[model samples]
Target: MSQEKLEKIEKAGFVLKPDSPEIRPNYERVREAFESRGIEVLLAERSARMIGEKGMPFERMCVESDFLVSLGGDGTLLSLVRRSYAWHKPVLGINAGNLGFLADVTIEEVETFLDQLFSGEYRIDHRLMIAGHIRKASGAKIEFFALNDVVISSPVTSKMVIVNAAIDGERFNSYRGDGLIISTPTGSTAYNLAAGGPVVYPLTKAFILTPVLAHSLTNQRPLVVPADFRIELDTEKYEAVATIDGQERYDLEEGDVVTIGGAKEGARLLHRKERNYFSVLRDKLHWGERNW
Candidate 1:
């Protein structure tokens, strides 16, 4: 192997999602492939547990690893992206589920993917992130970041909630609805799309505000905002909750305020050579040539 090729392969450390049964077997196969060639393998804590790994902190595994691999669907890829952002590591996604926009590489492609990766045949794309700071009138503050979206909504069975949103400290709009989604361009295809938001290009530098099942017909559409603006939502008069990436949740009380903006750091994602956004859309949504 060439000096640069060996350097690239030797410098990589892998991070895999633990829940998938396929990951353990695939991990072993990949481990053997690398070990046979004298390359090192680093595993995330949760993944280590699944593979019977012991004697290392999970965070340390990520910090030491150069390339992290997420071995599941889009959600797994999202979690890995957040971890990579926190650790400043780049991530590769291997899809094992349906609608895997992020995790596009299939199991059959793993070996070839790794080879291309070491040979510098792939490209890395950085996706924008959103950070939110929530405060209550009583003086408590909480901070969170998301690769997908930050959602603010009322508890199940609760009445419609009212929110006053401001962009760049100026009054943007007051919404009377079930909830609101503040999504990154990468997330425009996720929950935002289901909520009627436009499918923005992944590389677009913009934010989307999509209302969920609004009570009023006039408030039915989604709003796209500039990525650099600061967005604030005042829920001081309503009962609500806040969520990030559909994983973390926080309760909202009267007089509580939530602020969201573009994050200084973003996620670096590795894309396979054959992956295409329009191709995925056409295949997943069945958008072409109807026989009926």
Candidate 2:
């Protein structure tokens, strides 16, 4: 990052979830590595005793730290990003699980990356996020922020849902499907892609709406709109749920309306300067491999 764009980082926030015994020792080793460089590091939340002392909660740690390091899979990093986006904290992902799409770094490589991190050999990717506001029939209001995607589906796994979606208050499309996905460019490869949505470039500023298993409306494909477009979703008939990043879920009764749009703040993902989106995609997906 350029000098002006980079914030002075002294204390690093660690987001380690589940507090497992096997990962504890590695966590301590990483913490010691950070502290050795005169950078104070704290766990984002309390952990297993094997990792030693309990660190502060996520909110406190985020506010106190110069930046954050997520030690888990993509799901864990997404949760951390959603909570810490308000602080605009740049987050580094250390993959401790399988198929870490967002958590792109391995535990073994983080030490080397830390040296480059403090030496100004990194870049910050400002990825856009989405916000979902729900107005229930009982006058209750709920709001959520998601770094990946917000999904709405039927309570029963086998049942299909009737969803009416409008863009900017204009009539758009209605679907009879299992669910719908409102994703950001950063989330194009998530549920959106699984449901046949286009794979948008991570840097693109757009909103993608993809319906899951639409009935009758075979033409109801994923819709990509400008980031500023306001999307309204009305679920009728079946009991449904609004799922945020697959972590937080809220039950939606009949007649509930959900408003989704671009969040005021986006997640800041930190990466080594040499890391390229296409290169990562190719390496992870085996794009150039031959079919023997």
**Where's the lowest-lDDT run of ten residues in candidate 1?**
1-10
Model 1 bad stretches (over 4 Å): 1-7, 18-22, 34-38, 217-219, 289-291
- Which residue pairs collide in model 1, if any? 236-255
Compute the lDDT for candidate 1: 0.77
Q: After superposition, how far is residue 150 of candidate 1 from its true place, in Å?
A: 0.6
Q: How would you encode candidate 1's per-residue C-alpha lDDT over 1-292 as one tens digit per residue?
A: 1122222555446666656545677767767766665567776666777767652566776766667777777888887777567776777787765657788887777778777776677777778898788987799899888989998888775478777899999997777888889999898888888888888888777899998878786746788888899999987566888988988889988788899998886677887655788998888767896889
Residue 82 C-alpha lDDT in model 1: 73
Clash counts for the predictions, in order: 1, 0
Off by over 4 Å in 2: 1-4, 48-52
Model 2 accuracy (lDDT, Cα): 0.82
TM-score attained by model 2 = 0.94
lDDT of each: 0.77, 0.82
